[model samples]
Target: MTLSVTRTARGMVQPSGQTPTGTLHLSFIDRLPVLRCNARTLHVFRHGHEPAEIIREALSKALVPYYPLAGRLKESSQGELQIACTGEGLWFVQASADCSMDAVNYFDNIPMVHHEKLLPDLLTEVDDLDPLVLMQVTQFTCGGFVMGLIFCHSICDGLGAAQFLSAVGELARGLHHPSVAPVWCREALATTAPQVYATGKANPPPPLPFLPDYQLKHATMDITPDQINQLKHEFQESTGQTCSTFEIVAARMWSRRTKAINLEKDAKVTLVIFANARQLLHPPLPKGFYGNCFFPVTITVSSEKVSQASHAEVVKLIQESKSMLPIEFTKWINGNSVGDVDPFAPPLAYTTMFISEWGRLGFNQVDYGWGPPVHMIPIQGSSIIPVAIVGTPPKPKKGIRLMTWSVSGPHLQNFLEQMLNLT
Candidate 1:
């Protein structure tokens, strides 16, 4: 189905109170090289109760506490990225589509091509002085609407973005105050860089663009409570060690995808885990610190090891990745300066997997008086590396739903079969 815009408007969501006049230093995790632009997403509501007026009004109030969101991305004399607290405001757009909610499967299964229409255009809406956040409320003929948002990664991670939206939902429901107050303590997570002794400094490497004419195949698979528990039981029986829900799921994926691709046995495979650092900070961030407080923990091993290894073996590697907290947390925080080479970059090889955990983010809990959202869809920005988004089960089941977007390849069928048979 084709989507058309019925009306469009920009809402100047300003801070409810005066905001400090200065640049907000972006923490090391916030300045990741790959996350330099706005990360787009789609929120679908089946029974259209969210009106443009309500959303805009609630957003204005929500911006009061998260004022930095209304600021623009700018660079300091040292060439470091920071949020210039100008109170410029966020961009709000309203659009309408010709299809019904059922026509698009209620967004439970999305076609890669239609995603472009459901999201705001970054090429035109984003600029150096433009607001760091842009939102579009797209309405459907059947009264359903999609809330599309573009959030600058330099300002916050996915968890931080959810914190802001939760506030908006509360305000829309006529709440006097947000459940969690927004906190800004970017400098608290800073770490001292260890001294480096080298013969000479080499010129920085250049950025790599996405693959040429890449095709993206998107799929959503659901795991049952019984299946989850069974997998955990099997792993514990084999290794005599228990694993978290995330560990079991990630291990299975690593094993299946690697075999499906049939890569060389000696090929190196890296599992990049995006870990949260809110509590890992020495003194801990405020209750609702809404900034980039997560870092990537990458574990690399030969393809033969991961593909042929049991789920328990893979889980052990993932646990090793998470164990880098506290001890490694200090070195990671202090080692990199503002302009230093990005601590990490997107994997240049097809053998790597990037896993993101969204189960605990509470995307479904965000209610704007219309009840909770039925589905949350992450718009893919790049297609070179395989990316997976793990979401909680629909009900209070012990399992989760994993959505993956990967470059179209021959191994898709094998990968899909293995994922479906995990039970």
Candidate 2:
């Protein structure tokens, strides 16, 4: 088969040996990179014949700007680049097929769930599991394809990674330059010698609090359009409040979870809201400032209160929590004004973490030559069931997608049933 290769900018492809040129952004240098983990699915379409050459060309060109990271695969001398931080991060693999590409195109169009139980098994196989990044491409028996990506948690937040993927997509589509340049602002993090100071003086800090231990169970629940409307009506009826899908689902799950854990009345059952701080910060971050750009805003209700609260009340509590996420609070956190805690420590807040990225903020606009991904799901981590709320596409009538980690099977089932009842 004759291959057609298109090279737009000669200099864009930096040779393998060169260091990243251009002035290193200072803030990016100062702060440790925040890790963001997620995945994207792609569907490849061929017109009559598979454009293998064109696809390869697009991938190569798109990956050029990210060449530094891609090229690091070739570099063994740089120990930092080669070393894996916690034996639990990214990995790359491939899947192959024997049939024609067209025969498999239909299968590529849909979304597939990565089974939860398979995670530990998957993790064990990858060397240096933590800090491991993966890019797995599967080729079906026909010409169809699937791509899976896994990122670490300490490098970039979800938004940051989305920004990076957008760039790659633009490049793959033959854009000479990315619409938004990547930003690096790690230096902006406060420069206190010690992360925390005791009584206004520097002192060795006490051991950080340990995160609660819990196993996650995953299940898929469906809600009908009528059911969704009913749930919305019931929510307003119960608490004189209108709630987003996230609020309703999150509230039900949180309540049931606390009940199952048997948390005490006096103990705080905190629902952490991962609020994006990008726009809130003074001199808002540039489009490229992809590090950890979100902070936790929490609502700590007594377990008893939570158990007794109506769905509306929970929604309101979630809404009120947003008020605590002012940019100043983040500034305080980065400045060490608040109690200093080790960045590497296990989660300090009460165990639960909720993250939402439902509205695609141009995240799906990433159009490598193939087209934007149909779905994206986060594989849950060990201790926490980080809930990622995603917006459903046009065809899938599902109200919303809840990607959760480490939730109990029975509790999750109960929460879904309750949600359906409310609906």
Candidate 3:
């Protein structure tokens, strides 16, 4: 399928007259290492109303509460990021694809060359002035369409973006207001005490020299519900405890990927996962606190252990790592010095895997008057650490769709074989 651009425009979703206007500082959570990067998402719908008109109108309403999204990001003298609430517009593009959704196999294993056509390009580099978010609405010949969004990680995280998008959908459906009000409490995570580091941003140094480049390859695969259940059952029977689907699946992938690369038996490996802290903080954030509210949990083990350990064993290790969420979040909130290491840093020695679960993120619930999205996918596949983007399966099906991006090395085939054979 080929996509042709029809229009390129920008719209300013100004805050209401009563809304306050000023520079808003980024919270500690917002400055997390990986949060500085940009992320993309695509929402697919069938035979929907005029998506361009609906989205523009709904976005204006959403921006009244999500004004920061319309603002421009700037760096402070200390090198920290802050939103300058100038009411500047966001970039939006309109395009049409020559083929229908089914013709592209519902975006299953979409070619990398074509993926760039579906979303906005990554900024050459993070600069002082740039749109916090960019979006594209592409219509297919069969009347189906997709909404692609690229958001700067400095402004918000996945949950924040989802909340704002949900508001747009609610407004498109003619709701008088959003289901949840947006909240900003950056001061709560700020400190009156002076800091000595550069912006206190603590951007980590580059990875050590030994890490091998993976040549950046991407693929999407699915895991049947039965496969998930079987793994869970086996782990429970062996360990006398049940594990969440994500924990089990992530552990399995970590084990398999390490073995696939034929790493030295005694090399070190690490698995990193971010846990939400909205309700985990000492005094929980507001119900709709829309910002970066998560911390990364890293688990290090030897390659031999990661490759040879039982599924139950790895899951237990992940569980233990997660159990420290509250403590870690509190430390970040109190302005304590957190590790300078990047959570998504490249795995140089043995292996490093970062796993993110979007199934419960309500990707399928962002309805814009013509029912919910039929499909969604994230752009920006990484080549450093292997990444697994897991989402809920299609309706009436019992399973998950796993989209992974890795280096196109000799290990690629073995890694994929192990993943597919798990079912």
Candidate 4:
């Protein structure tokens, strides 16, 4: 029989204590054009005792300091987004699967389509009164559980999400208070220049085209430690400079993806890479300030330039783009600019590439008494543009896992050749 998940219980989990109620304005970073959506992640735990209940209870307590999560999204009279801390609570669901962890290979090999079922479904388009946080815990027959968490992107970035998840884990372990007291200083990130935001509100980017299921293909490939080392050695030999593994992989991905898609020589191809911007601020955001602070480092060039460029050359291009992040961030924070493209909502006909690096986002560090999760993956894959997500390696594994989505006919096969043919 095909395995299935059954929801045993579901409800709103309220805070353990009275939470402050008010209308909290969002930060400038929180109002980015591309951040008006939900973020999703699934975590796998191989062993745990009543994890669903433990997490459910812990979530209630976790909502006190993170009270804004218990609230709903609302709009101000001036048509700006803000939070109404109603103490309505977060949506929680307890579920059980008919199969064991081993049945699915600990979810390491599961398809992205199946991951969609694990997360709580929400409207593709969010609106006022929508819950900011929604979560579900599906317990496996073998005492393991998979936690599907979705939070508003406007509230936090990947690193900020990690911070919130870590709090829930700590509370589940019976901690009286979070190690890092949560901070809500959105004003610190307020922008002096509001034209970009105001203009975005008036003329939002066009809606993304959701391709038919058959037209999209989701695939992944692993880059092992040895392979990474070899690439680093090759890069240093050729360029006489050191770079992160992401720089090498992303550079290669851009180069091969451009060639595989067969864009016009003069066609414009863009790459948007996710990078942390907490320290890029003049004085830096305060610690424990969980909010949207990731900046998309973008670079666009002619297809002829990227597709024909050497791997080392492509890496240099990405490096140059990244090096400009500090200046770009400074300008944006001061309201002097809006990025070339939105991080999540890039503009393109068929030549946009997006890369989000999750290896250092702290997802692997969240542990709920039973110990940290052994594996984690995002539930995604239904976009017209080619996108790649690099996640932290699961336990006992080294290096990173690449999850890719492309609508092109030769997308996966060509990408595989690019990954393996590093000669």
Candidate 5:
């Protein structure tokens, strides 16, 4: 169904109260060279009981605590990135759709909903939009709304973004403070440049572009819970080892994707596992750090192995990846890393497959009076890398949804056939 959405208003929203002023040093995890990208998401709500102003106002108040978000991204004298506490404010847009929630099936009909129209355009923005956070509230005729947001990847990961948004919801609901108070002590995760640049200098390398060029067809696949459980059982039976939901799912999907892409027989394929590292630290990061903390664990094997290996073999590789987090986390936070990644590090943008597990991020639980969001959508903006967003299904649904932007043409057809015929 074709839907028409009209932009109603736009402006910058400043913090409701005075915030600290000065530069906030970014941690090693926050300034990862391979993590320079934006995380765009879509949230579906079922009620219009809350006006757009309510969220806008709440966002202002939320900024009082999450002031780093309102600040602009700055580059230090050494080319490293940091947040300058200017508190310029958040960029907000108001929109309305001619159709209702039912018309788009509450955004569950991923292929039918015009996500681009539901989001704010970064190209035409004048709010010093160099990776600045942007939000859009699009109201539907049925008194429901869709909230779209764009967060700077360098500033926060998926879970961190959810925490911040939830804070905004708390304020909207008239809370004096967030249940999980905001914490900004990021220096604990900072790097010391143990290995200087090959030029023997102290500065880090220049950052890659935040977004990858989109040249592949984007599609979302919904896998039922039954299929997931069956796969899990099969994996354990085959490997004689019990694996978590992500291990088996990632293993199977990686194998299937490898076969679909039909890469060279001996090409080395890297599976990047974006594991949450909140608990792997020496003292563990606080519950409310709200910054980039996920450690991208990589497992590289021959394409032949990935395509031919039994689900057990691939899953074991994934298990190995996660098992190395403790040591890797130690090196990263202890400043043994070079620009947060060594030369031997697998180039994440070129990794064979990059999948972000969002099922546990609590993004769908953000509510500002209207019930929890029914769906959390991810917009694959101009991202150049081949990445997939694996997230929890909307309400009343029992399964996971995989939004893929890695393959196209016959590859997509093959992948779809495997998904629909999942046993």
Candidate 6:
């Protein structure tokens, strides 16, 4: 979709607040394209039908401390730095009351709703929308609701945005003061000078050709516990190998998608797995070091390998890739060693992607005084289908919940069938 830029009243505000002192640097990773979308839902208490005034009041108060950086958009002026605080940046709104609570809940329950439809619908209505970043609230008929969030990779990574959202939830509930305060580390991400580079090593791979005028498509499927188990058993039975929920599903879908696209056999596809390194690094990142801190752990293989390989072999390859990540990887990113690399280079084989929130450890306890959310559904992006595994909300009988954005309706249906077999 074409991204239109227009001036707005919100973008003119100056950064007059108590800005932090140090230069928070972001490493030179590609300006994570404006292509990223981090969507999610939150179910509220049954009786929590506070008037829209109260809700707005709560959000206003909670978001004040974050205002300085929250609504600001990025702008580059003559190769110099500039931040546009007016007319652009983060966007927030509340969905119309026409849709009932049950309808909203039903919508959330539908796995991986396609962004092609949902995102455009949201943008068309929210006029001042920035394809780069935005968030909104949708109320349901049952007095319950969902919070939809979207972030531009240029601002914060998925984990970074989650950190920001958790803080918002906490502030609304009157929890502790805004966490760790927001910091802009964009300067730290400047490209390195050629002299600083280590010579003799292989030069970074050529940058991936940008995909031209691509359109977004998304799909989702729901699977029962029994079905999931059966899929797992079938995969093991077929290949004598086991895969994590994401690996198994991802492998199958990637193979199918590449074939459908009519890709060449020797062409490699890249599976970019978003790894949450919050606790994996040394001296672990502070509880509030929000920004794009995630590093992609890629698994590259050709379409032929993916099509001919057994499920077990693919699973092993995925597992091996994950195992390769270490604390040093973060350091590598921070040090700019990763700069020589291209963020979009196509893989040697069919590529698919995975991101999981299995533990739900950090933000699950977000109690905004209204009580913790009974459910949370993340919106899927337009580029690549992402798999997110989150803990079911506290209220709905303790168990694991899986959510994913699909590339096609047929692919999603087939995936749900395989996942059902696992159960």
Estimate the TM-score of every prediction. 0.88, 0.68, 0.89, 0.92, 0.89, 0.65
* Ten residues in sequence with the least summed lDDT for candidate 1: 195-204
The residue-level lDDT of candidate 2 at 362 comes to: 57
RMSD after CA superposition, every candidate: 4.0, 8.2, 3.4, 3.0, 3.5, 7.3
Candidate 5 regions exceeding 4 Å error are 122-125, 129-131, 193-214, 335-345, 348-351, 382-384
lDDT of 2 by residue, 1-423 (tens): 111112121111222233343222222212332222334333232221233333334444444444323322111232111221111212334344445444533332222433221121143543432322344444444444444555443345667666766775666567777777765565554344343311121122355456555555554444455655776788788778677766666676676556655566788766765567778765677767766656667666688988777767776787777766684455554563445543323253434545565445555555656665544444444444445354443223446655455355556665456544542
Clashes of each: 4, 37, 2, 0, 4, 43
| Model 5 TM-score (2 dp) | 0.89
Which pairs of residues collide in candidate 3?
211-348, 214-407
Candidate 2: Cα lDDT at 147: 47
lDDT of 1 at 253: 79
Model 3 whole-model lDDT (C-alpha atoms): 0.72
Off by over 4 Å in 2: 1-94, 97-133, 190-213, 223-243, 259-262, 331-336, 340-353, 358-363, 383-395, 409-413
lDDT of 1: 0.74
Taking the tens digit of each residue's C-alpha lDDT, what string does model 6 give over 24-48?
2233342333223344433334334
Each model's lDDT comes to: 0.74, 0.48, 0.72, 0.80, 0.77, 0.48
| Per-residue lDDT of candidate 4, residues 267-374 (tens digit) | 999998989888977689889989887777888899999988888899899999999989887776676665453343557446778888888788898999888889
> Poorest 10 consecutive residues of model 4 by lDDT?
196-205
Between 5 and 6, whose TM-score is larger? Answer: 5
lDDT of 5: 0.77
lDDT-superior candidate, 2 or 5: 5
Q: How far is 39's C-alpha from truth in model 2 (Å)?
A: 7.8
Candidate 1 shows a clash count of: 4
Q: Alpha carbon lDDT of residue 56, candidate 1?
A: 83
Per-residue CA lDDT of candidate 5, range 231-322, in tens?
88888788777888777678777888888887889888887777888888768888788887776787878889888887788888888878
The Cα RMSD in angstroms, rounded to one decimal, for candidate 6 relative to the true structure is 7.3
User: Per-residue CA lDDT of candidate 3, range 260-349, in tens?
Assistant: 877788888888887776787656788777787677788888899988887788888899999887776565455464656434344443
Query: Which structure among the candidates has the greatest TM-score?
Result: 4
